[model samples]
Target: MVRKKFSKKEIFTGIACTLFALLILSLYVWHQTESVSLGYDSAELEYRVTQLEKEVEKLETIKSSLLTLDRVENIARDKLKLSEPKEEQIVYEHIEKER
Candidate 1:
């Protein structure tokens, strides 16, 4: 069996190469982790947007139903005991628009 002795330069080169490879691998792993985390956040935000849109639609439907003319007329006639104006009590006006 032959014994081989390595020089100081060779040992230092090997250590430096190993450290550089480790640093590159660490950077790659960190980048991949950030990408995955951002993907999850984007999906969560999209789901939140969809939920908000649905809520807005539901609120608009409720507003429309509440503002119906039939309901308002019923409330006005029955609750306020108001009657229609007579022909003598009515007046008409004409207005000109500015250009």
Candidate 2:
């Protein structure tokens, strides 16, 4: 039996098939590169989350410290100089409007 030579249409069809397969492979690689599954991007995100959690804990500690009775009383007495008033020394002044 004689060997049958490939026709031009058949050769072009083979090239098209190869190019299509290559295109599909390239698309797959592109998708995988953009996705964050088991990659450096995921690790970076996890690290950022951990840092944010630590900052939140620090802020909470500072907030609790500020709310203590000692801190409140110290600020009030030092800054405002408020004191208990004696009943006999207490006086009220009435202001008159100028015409």
Candidate 3:
């Protein structure tokens, strides 16, 4: 029976190769995890944007209703106690244009 003994250099080389392979595998796993995390972050941001858009639409509707002519007239009449001026209290203005 003949047995071949491994040299110290060969043993060290094999260990280094195994370590390098493990490092590559770990880097791959890390990259995949990072990609998944970014996807979740993007989804969360999209959801937040959708919610903000809805809120903006609601706020715009409220503003539109508040700015209606009838709403403004009612607020002025009820809050300021104002009324239309009579014929004697009304005034007119005239301007002459230069030719």
Candidate 4:
């Protein structure tokens, strides 16, 4: 039967190697966590961008409709009762004094 005892130098080298391995492992885990967090933030920003694009498209459609002659005529006729003047129609204006 034979048994080998480790020398002081060998034990110290083993401890140093173990510590280095632990440090590397901790750094790798931290990097992985940060990567996941960044991915989630990126996805959130993408979703917000998509929502804003949809809103912009809707606003563009509304703007186009508002700029049409037909839409303007409809609003003027319905809201303001505007009409074309006939030859027989007489117009009068009365001015009020501002106090």
Candidate 5:
């Protein structure tokens, strides 16, 4: 049987290469994890945007209802005890514009 011995230079080169390969593998894993995390964050942000859009639509609907002329008239007549003016209470005004 013959036994072979590796030289110091060869051993050092092998160890360095192994360390470099490990470093690269770790970097690749870290990058992949970061990419996945960012993907999840982006999805969450998209969901939030959708929720906000829905809320905006709801608020707009409420605003429209509140601002309707019929609603205002009802509030004025019922709550404020206001009524339409009589024919004798009406008046007309004319204004002239100068160019």
Candidate 6:
């Protein structure tokens, strides 16, 4: 049997095709890794947003409780040592509006 010799053009073409296939494979792998990273980042951000929403709701509840009339009156009477005015000490004022 005679050994067949390869041409220079055939060898170059083979090498180039191999290199291109490797490049395409690398790019695909890189894109897959980047997609996974972005997915993890998005999930983390979503969790943080949920936590912040819960915190906002908790703060709103505390604010509402602090603003109640009974709480305010208790704080003023106990902490500030203030008292309501007697009925005899109350006064009324009248104002006239211009048309």
Model 5 error, position 31 (Å)? 1.1
Model 3 C-alpha lDDT versus the unseen true structure:
0.92
Q: Pick out the ten consecutive residues of candidate 1 with the lowest summed lDDT.
A: 90-99
- State each model's CA lDDT, in order: 0.92, 0.87, 0.92, 0.90, 0.94, 0.94
- Per-model TM against the reference: 0.70, 0.65, 0.74, 0.57, 0.70, 0.73
Candidate 5, residues 5-75, lDDT tens digits: the string is: 99999999999999999999999999999999999999999999999999999999999989999999999
* Clashing pairs in model 2, backbone N/Cα/C closer than 3 A: none
Report clash pairs, candidate 3. none
- Candidate 6 residues 3-98, lDDT tens each? 888899999999999999999999999999999999999999999999999999999999998899999999999999999999988755443233
| lDDT, candidate 3, at 64 | 99
Candidate 1 lDDT tens digits, 40-91: 9999999999999999999999999999998988888999977789998875
- Mind sharing the TM-score for model 6? 0.73
Task: For model 2, state the Cα shift of residue 18 in Å.
Answer: 1.0
Once fitted onto the true fold, the runs of candidate 4 whose alpha carbons sit more than 4 angstroms away are 1-17, 84-99
- Comparing 1 with 4 on lDDT, the higher-scoring candidate is 1
For model 5, the superposed segments whose C-alpha errors exceed 4 Å read: 1-9, 85-99
- Among all candidates shown, the one with the greatest TM-score: 3
Candidate with better lDDT, 3 vs 4:
3
Q: In angstroms, give how far residue 50 of model 2 lies from its true place.
A: 2.0
